[model samples]
Target chain A: MKNIFTGRDIVSDKGYITKRNIIEKSLQLFSVKGYYNTSISDILAATNLTKGGLYGHFASKADIWQAVYDEAVCIWRERVFSGVRDRTDPMIRITKFIENDLRNYLGADVFEGGCFFLNMLVELSGQSDPMSKQILRGFVRISKLIQAWLDQAADQGLLKPGLNHKEIANFIVISLNGAAALYTSTRDDTIVDQTIEQLGFYVRQLKA
Target chain B: MKNIFTGRDIVSDKGYITKRNIIEKSLQLFSVKGYYNTSISDILAATNLTKGGLYGHFASKADIWQAVYDEAVCIWRERVFSGVRDRTDPMIRITKFIENDLRNYLGADVFEGGCFFLNMLVELSGQSDPMSKQILRGFVRISKLIQAWLDQAADQGLLKPGLNHKEIANFIVISLNGAAALYTSTRDDTIVDQTIEQLGFYVRQLKA
Candidate 1:
């Protein structure tokens, strides 16, 4: 992990940290004020970077936004995905995946602003841009990951007969995003608990 | 219904229509670009109104936003709520509410961008402002409405024994917002269908 707070950076980590600093600062703003509301000047003021300094690292505001999004995905993997990535049991992995996102990833450590991908997804929807397409790809990737686990669960005979893993995965993804949408705005932990409980109920019902 | 397209204002409806025009245009921009991203200039250009003319109706951008949100609530009543408002049966009312929101409201006619309340809630979360509080009130209103229906269902022995209407309402609210988050971004009707199907399943399980 790049140390974004250190005033002085080591020779090897300086450039990387500087870039990380810009991305982190811009992300905080973008997640809060949103992409269009956030300006280059806002990022510069937040990061204490000159126009030339910021531009040297990022060509434009859009460039910085892309980096922020990439970093957000990395944060998801490190904070949420990494926990479930190595689990051998598909059911456990799926359960852990949902658990981590609801209990931790959507919590303050990962983002007080809530799920970054979902935020960007809704914010950038209907836009005809590379960024928009890229966001869509991110959702597709996450959906595929969930669906793969669900398929494996079926193969292992862990699911109820005739159950559709694809639709189940869709339900998990949709409901989780919905829970985030509510919890993110409400900052109400009970909402998270309720959503998780319901999800757990669904998973248990799929037991053979 | 106020005629939004007419250039010549009917005498009694002149002031009402002018305010409606500003609200309508601002709602469109706020729906697409969000509240903070939208500027007064953007609204002016969209409405073809001079600054003074616009200010005559609203004092500031925030004022316009408040109006936009109010208009959004009104739209909700007309398009989604009105269908379920008069129904005395709790189960049928809840079903109609969800169906109208998913099938009609979240569809293109009501908001090509998506649910205005959800958008604002997510966009305005964690902010220290009147707008944020207003948005919170909107969510509370919806949640209470859903909860009331669930409570009625429970009282009438239309629900599963030991069922908790509070949690169920929370689940419904969270999941519906989730569906909107996905459907808004994907523009896929199938996602809506899947969410509705799952919700219907939940409703069916509540039967005694």
Candidate 2:
């Protein structure tokens, strides 16, 4: 039998679509209710699929989580970085990335609950499982991206000579996550506006 | 009967002790595993209590959650505010609060998983239940404390004129929450140190 959940085979075109549909529904459920709170039965209920049907698509909920996470990363990258990918100026790229993240992705509430990664990051903080690693890996990837840009800025003599790039990257990540979490709970867009403005000021101040 | 979960009547002294014991254990479980992920069975296992014994203390899991949250709040206030509560200088109170929060609370890993309020705030972000409300209220209480201090500083001509007190309070909160969440996930002490230093700088900068 063909399988889309695993990369063993191409799977049938219809099977691929069905798998995608399951992933999409599960993403919403997991984003809002989180991984542990959301169960296979919830997936089946939300997808309107029978147990046998859902199991046929993904071997387990963990595999489905991996697939959902991959989809979220793609959406995050496309929405937050697509505009700045071609920009060579590091400050432009960094500022635009923060702007896109704050205004477009987080402020826009791309996911029903909020940023998929932030919600899952807090949800999976202490777990040592593969599921938890995936969330941490996403955070590392973003941190690395920002660190790379900061290093690039330093190489170009745009950023100050003595700043710790990694710490700065972590700071940006922490502040944005905190802002997004608070905004989600409060449903106050002003938090988003203030965060965007403040973070923007911090980013610009990083210049040489 | 004397009831601790609900203030109805007095039960046995053993009952009150048992109730307190359950709340303490459940606070650990819920801090790490979160509300929906932790089950009544998990509580029974952690506390080594029978199903009937557990039921006698809490009307439901939700009630247990309330008791645990109240206990966490008391602990939080006592640790994070006890020193600053006696100080009259707003900046001293503010910096002392942040220092206690970072150095003593988060940096020391006072809770096994991390800050209880940060964990629960993210866990319950989108929910509208009373449990979620309690977490949000904890956040609001903190924010209000900071904002009130900021306003007091302004009145004393210690804070820079025309600063948005509410926005500044939110910034400190957003940054600290972000810092704690990241620190919890990474188990990095430098994050806490850097956060304290930077937040201290930011606080000092707020003065006239």
Candidate 3:
């Protein structure tokens, strides 16, 4: 296909492409060395870009950090939410969602660090930054998704009568985060395995 | 009161006192800025120690990290485990243990970066350093404690009849770690409230 756009148009397209590249690379570095530890120089080095090139796309180091956070949220929503969207059975859908999540997390090119949410949560919790607000919005979004999933499960009779969807949703979110924390810290799949098993047991208990 | 040993003994006591101060200050800095982000100069600035004086105690930056980890583990054991040592009722003891844990973790001074276990877990998980090994050991030790508590509770008919102690223990640990992760990220007490509520619900299920 012949491209009609040229010059400034191509430059804008390349700008988006370069920004994505920088964000992905920054995510890996930040996950490994953490946000505070990863400097602008580190991001530049990873992207093999000059300071002028980097700043042309991002106003500051904080701007790039926000971009990375946004990309991570996008990937998580697509990978975890989209994977479970088609299933009619709540129990199966939930199980598949957990399975896909573990697979994506573990089947990585590098074990840089843990979940972006958990990493950002710990790193930015006490610091007041633009990125902190983004992290909070991401967390609230995940919790709400879990709540919605549980509510659907209960409505569909996949959950036992009188089960508390809100409580169970909170438990699922907390336990999954915990499992991710443990897995990232230990780099052991067993923690993930145990979490999966325990989650399965909890879900099975919801059956009438 | 007159000390029994003078001169050398007093000097030794002073040495111990200074070392404790170094470790305490190092913990705060590392917890705040993390391991790689913290430099020897940062420690010196925080403690007002000259290079020679710091070298007199810790051999390197890694040595200081190890000391911080050890001190954190020591305090964690004393605060969380000591309360559960003598209780015969597993359910009651576990509940008390969780409550004590929440209190310690949610305290204003200690609540900044969440639990040290979690901080190190994310910070040190992929590294091949001795400190990483120590971090792993601490994780195993904490998980085993939960396992033991669950086993005891199950034996005494304190847990739901069909529950597996190992699985439940894993769930409890994961949930606790997850709560810490959330609290660390959000720096909000709502996560702690959710954790306490979840633990209470689980405990009730365990009780006959």
Candidate 4:
């Protein structure tokens, strides 16, 4: 059978749309109520799909959780990370990554429901599930992005001699995630702005 | 009815112990699995309590969650905040609060599972439950403690002129929480130490 998602089959277009619909709706609920609190019935109710319709699209709640997490990471990479990738200057690149991607895209606006990756980290970190592994992989990816930039900047002699790039990257990631959590609770935009500002100050202090 | 918790009967002492047992065990699970994922059955399994015994103590999972939250906050305040309260110097108090209460008590060792307050904040914020309200109150209380110290430090002319105490307090709270979340997943002791060290640097930069 041709898949409607790929326009390969007109017959299965409805099936593809139905599956996409379920995933979209599930992502909204999972990001807000969380994966555990968000019940299958909640997905059905929100999607206005009967039990059969919901089950037809995703076999189980866990299946939909995987979809949601994958989609979230994809969005962060394509929507957020892509923009920050083109800058040639490491300092400018890193700062923009923090300001645009970390502070703006991953901040309260795109994730007003809450950061899916961070939510997963808090909710599923220690569990030996595929979900936990994927979340950890995302952390490593982001940390490497920051560390690479810091290392490049150090090579360019913009930063002080003997700077610990990995430690600095960890500091930035820890602070950004922390800021995101605080902003999620308080809905205080200042926290986000202040985090970026403080991070900038830390970087400037490292200048040669 | 005479309360077993009040030692009205020998049988009641068992009841009190049973109730305490449920809360303590639930705290561990909730810290990791979170409130929603942690089913009553999980509690029964961990505590080896019968369905009726568990139900007798907590009407529902929500009830046990409320009790756990209250107990977590109480412990943080009494055991964590109390030590920081006794310091006469605002600088010493704030520093000790970061090192002793925050770094030692609420850091990785005590919160290897997850930070109870932060876990609740991430899981429950914007949910409109009494639990969410209580968690927000805890954030406010901690923020106030930090702000009070910053304000005093500024008044004592120990800080750089024209400092925004509220913003600084917000920074520290955000960073501490961010550090906690990172440590939860990585189990990296350096994250905890670096968080304290970075916080100290922030404070020293504020000093006159």
Candidate 5:
């Protein structure tokens, strides 16, 4: 066997088009019905792809799930990091990052399905899925990203001197995640606005 | 044709005993596997009950879902209210309520599944499901409870005289939910501890 189906080429190839379609449809279905609620048949119905077609790319439902999660996390990291990267001020960059997230997640129909990582947090809290571990690792990665941003801001004298960086970082991340949860639950724009305002207040408080 | 199925009677009866058992088991399953992932057969296997026995109380799988949700919400309300009712000082009561909730949710293996409302919120964000509506209503009820506590605390000179009660209440409720999200995702005790600390700090800021 050639085993030509091994890496990025697998996803980049035309033959793997079904795999990409499966991931896209899976993201939509999983976002709507959730990871557990969405069946293989549901995916098949959405994509009009046969089981063999799906199985050809992924080993099992869990394999497809891991792919969907990886893709979602990749998108979130790129969007969030790129959104705030150009700003010189740490506070402004943080705010912009949050605003960008809100706009993407709550602004339009783009994320009317809610944040994928947050959803996984709820759906896989106690479940022993490899995907669950991946989700937690994603949170740590994101939290570290936020912490790094805050550290830069502090180093530049943008944030209050003596502010506990790790604590504040955790606070910001948890608050943002909480805000996302509230927005998802209410499907109300007000929650997102309140979150924005709260973040603003916290940012101001960070100034000397 | 007696229509003798009173909610209480059915909940307490023998034949309906298995029905309730099935619902409880289904809740665990659904919470873990999600609504679509767990089938009737899965429920049967979990509860060791036959189809006829399962259908004795619930007319269908949807009925079982509704019953499980109702039961979960009822228990959550009791837990929240019980925590709130014990303290006279609104601020202290609110703190205690959150503390109790954190203790209960984080301590127990069962609630480690995350907030049922939070879970459903993500699962049904843009969809029209009776369970979704019910979850939203539950959030409203919780927000109202927080508002009432804030009002009472203000009256008792526990809160700042001119604080926006509704907004504060909203922030608190949303933050608490967010905290629940963080805890559920990370399964870290520190998240809950940090939430309590931040909440306590916020409450102190509200003191008259």
Candidate 6:
């Protein structure tokens, strides 16, 4: 899992811990302050690391950003699929995924800014760069995951045979992203509660 | 209405035109590049204005952001409400508002990024600042507008008497913001087309 990272020559335990610490601090900064909004100084301030000390671990701000972003995605994946990843039932897995997304991913409060990926998706989508393309690919991947679940459900004779899986998957993605953006800003519970309930109903209605 | 803006002491036509020109140029930069990503240098490069010339028109980058953002909202409001703003039929107004939102507002391609407000909503909502509050307030205002239309439909005997207007309005806002975010990045027409059709069906299903 590459949980341990260090300079090539410095494989000391302290160096590995320092590198991980830098990533953890920078994740909070990037999640809330955003990519461009977060300055190198912010990371330094948050991590209490000098430029030399910080650079000893990462090459530059971009290097730290990549490390932080990767870690955030790891946390998000673990949270969103904690209990349901190993489930046997496709329908129950789908339900648990949505529940984990609402109560665990967006509701985890791990990052100060709520869902790190969605915030990045929103911010990066505005810019034209490889990162923007990366964010879109991430959305497509999640959509595909949901579609696979729906297909499995259909195979299990639970979902309708003629329903469009891609459309439904995209719709679910939109709803979850909307709920995160709206709930994070408004701090309104109904946004999350209603979305969870409505989406459950939407998926259940697709049953054969 | 505020097509013309002038400095307190300089009401010259050249100053008025230059200020408007700056606003127009900055709007494009902020729309696609985002609030924090767009630097004063980018704005200057786009406008070909000296630092002095740019500062003469607006007090600071924050001032320029406010001007640029306000102009974007003005354009958005006009685009979303152009045909049905004064329409007498509440149901038709609701339908047209959704249509305009999908085809006219999000689909207008007025801003380089897509929906200016939605992008800002996603970006600024990540940062805890006055701008975030303003963005949430803007969402609420839109929700209230939709709720008013729903209420009007109910008053006119066109909608169910006991439907929850606030939830529906909030759901519509979430859907539109989601649609704009998804469509802008993916450039997928189905995001908008499906939203328009789904929302229309959703509203129609509320009949008395």
TM-score of chain B of each: 0.89, 0.91, 0.88, 0.89, 0.86, 0.91
Q: Give the whole-model CA lDDT for all candidates, comma-separated.
A: 0.80, 0.83, 0.74, 0.77, 0.73, 0.80
What number of backbone clashes does candidate 4 have, counting pairs of residues 3 or more apart or in separate chains?
A: 1
Model 1 chain B poorest ten-residue lDDT run: B1-10
- For candidate 6, what is the DockQ? 0.48
lDDT of 1 by residue, A105-167 (tens): 886537657777777777777653477678778777787888898888888878778866677
**Best model per lDDT:** 2
The C-alpha local distance difference test score for the whole of candidate 5 amounts to 0.73
Candidate 3 per-residue C-alpha lDDT over A5-112 given as tens digits, one digit per residue, 9 for 90 to 100? 544566677777898899899988888777787889898899999999988889987788778877777777666665687887767877777766666654332336
TM-scores for all candidates: the values are 0.90, 0.89, 0.86, 0.86, 0.82, 0.86
Supply the DockQ value of model 3. Answer: 0.60
Of 1 and 3, the candidate ahead on TM-score is: 1
Relative to the true structure, candidate 1 reaches a TM of 0.90
By TM-score, the better pick of 2 and 3 is 2
Worst 10-residue lDDT window for candidate 3 chain B reads: B105-114
Q: In terms of TM-score, how similar is model 2 to the real structure?
A: 0.89
Cα lDDT tens digits for candidate 3, B1-208: 3347654566677778889989999898777777777799999998898999899999998888888887887777677766677887777777777866766654333724568777777776665456667776766766688778878777876666776667677677788888777666666676777678767766676667
| Model 2 misplacement above 4 A | A1-11, B1-11
**Clashing residue pairs, candidate 2?**
B1-B9, B1-B10, B1-B11, B2-B9, B2-B10, B2-B11
- Candidate 2 lDDT, tens digit per residue, B1-208? 6566866566566777899999999999988888888999999999999999999889998888889888988888778886897899998999999888887888888777788888887778777456667777777789899999988888899987887887888888899888887788878898888787767756776678
> Cα miss at B109, model 2 (Å)?
2.1
lDDT of 3 at B128: 44
CA lDDT, candidate 3, residue B157: 66
Clashes of each: 1, 6, 1, 1, 2, 0
- Runs of candidate 6 exceeding 4 Å displacement: A1-11, A86-89, A126-128, B1-11, B85-92, B126-128, B154-162, B198-208
Q: For residues B1-208, write the lDDT of model 6, one tens digit per residue.
A: 2234532444466687899999998888777878888899998898889999988878888888788778887988888888887899888888898889888877768888777777777778746368878878888899899899889888889987777788878877887887887877867778877777656656666788
Question: Lowest summed-lDDT stretch of 10 residues in model 5 chain A?
Answer: A1-10
Cα displacement (Å) at residue B130, model 6: 2.1
Instruction: For candidate 4, write residues A99-208 as lDDT tens digits.
Output: 87556566636654667777778877676457767786777778788889988888888888976777777777787788777777767677777777777766677778
